[model samples]
Target: MYVYLSKIVPLFLMPLGLIIFAAVLVLLLLVTGRRRLAAWLLSFTVLLLWLAAMPIVAGSLYGRLESRFPPEPLARIPVSSCIVVLGGAVGLPFAPRQDIELTEAVDRVYKAVQLYREGKANRVFVAAGNQPRSESGPSEAALIGELLVEWGVPADAIQLEGRSRNTRENAVNIKPMLEATGCDRSLLVTSAAHMQRALASFKEVGLYAYPVSTDVRAIRRTEYTAMDFLPDAHALAMTSDAIREWMGQKVYQWNGWN
Candidate 1:
């Protein structure tokens, strides 16, 4: 119940949920003949949606998170005991689909492979999981491990921690494996915006990892064009994602997970 609650409870605080709630309230007010209250709520919801879909707003939210961990070249980072790649890259071939569809975060997997090939680490640790009621199949760690082997990484060098379903669980589940392998230090590969929470979670579990970020979405510009103020679907998605990340990190802090 707690695991499911962890996943579902945060939605109520996000833009979509709040908008929906406000809209429903507006309708209720109208049914109760409270026209003025309904009008105010309807107007507020529209304004909220407009701001959330603006590229300028999206850019600012993403920039704050992505800018925290700037990318470093392979040469600049010292070789670590192992490479830890967090999940959200790809999933197994479910029924009706024989091929895995990779996500934007698939760069995490590619970067891990590059680090291994470049001798940055001899071993790679993939930390991923499926939700409680996910389609029954291989865990994401197994899928990622297979990809690593297909991409030239030796099969024996890959370690899979597949039961973790969130950032906190990722750190907790991988703890014993790192201890058993004596991987006292690691290179953590994940999306740039996600690195802040990922790094903190790992540290909470006593793992010392250096950041290796990828999939940065923040636009680098001293100024924005007029188009940036226009509403866009992609901008809305970015804004939602940035808000989720912020909310997740705050929740993690409150729970002492990081």
Candidate 2:
């Protein structure tokens, strides 16, 4: 239920959603002979959209979330009992594509494989499952497990907790398995922007996880070009992602899962 709500509610609260809502309201007001109020609302909505699409504003907003957890250097990564790799790094296989499609967060899979090869963790625990309760395709964890085996990690060394649909479910479902395997401490691999909430969720479930942040989106320098001030679609998307994470954190806290 929480997963469904998170997916639906955010569409009405994010920048683009709010702009669309305002535009529709403005149209309604204008049709009702409320030109003065409609004009003001339309102007405000346009200005808000412009600001949200600027690279400088979006970068700063995303930076704050990504910077909450720094990536652990490969050489300095601590050894742990297991490596827990969360899902959302791959797209489910669809028609015309027989293989699992990797997404921006594929770094999570690569980092987990690297840790296993480096002997940082004796086993890899993949926490993911199919959505819509699919019965025909492999779960995300199963595909990741296959990838690990192809990369030379023994099949026996990989564990699949393929029943979780979200971060909180991942923590709740994986904790018991980890405990059963005597793996109280594990390296948690996920995107840098999502690390804080993921960590908090695991901690709330009484699991001790060392963060191995991947797919960092924060800029390191203060340098900016003229184009940075201009409106961009990519910038707007990044801002939306940041806003979603912020809302996710708040929701997780409220649910006592973080």
Query: What's the TM-score of each model vs. the native?
Result: 0.95, 0.95
Check candidate 2 and list the clashing pairs.
Answer: none
Off by over 4 Å in 2: 133-136
lDDT of 1 by residue, 105-132 (tens): 8999999999999999999999999887
Candidate 2 weakest lDDT stretch, 10 residues: 129-138
lDDT of each: 0.91, 0.90
The per-residue C-alpha lDDT of model 2 at residue 127 equals 99
Leading candidate by lDDT = 1
- List the pairs of residues colliding in candidate 1: none
Q: Native-vs-model 2 lDDT?
A: 0.90
> What TM-score does candidate 2 get on C-alpha atoms?
0.95
In terms of lDDT, the poorest run of 10 residues in model 1 is: 130-139
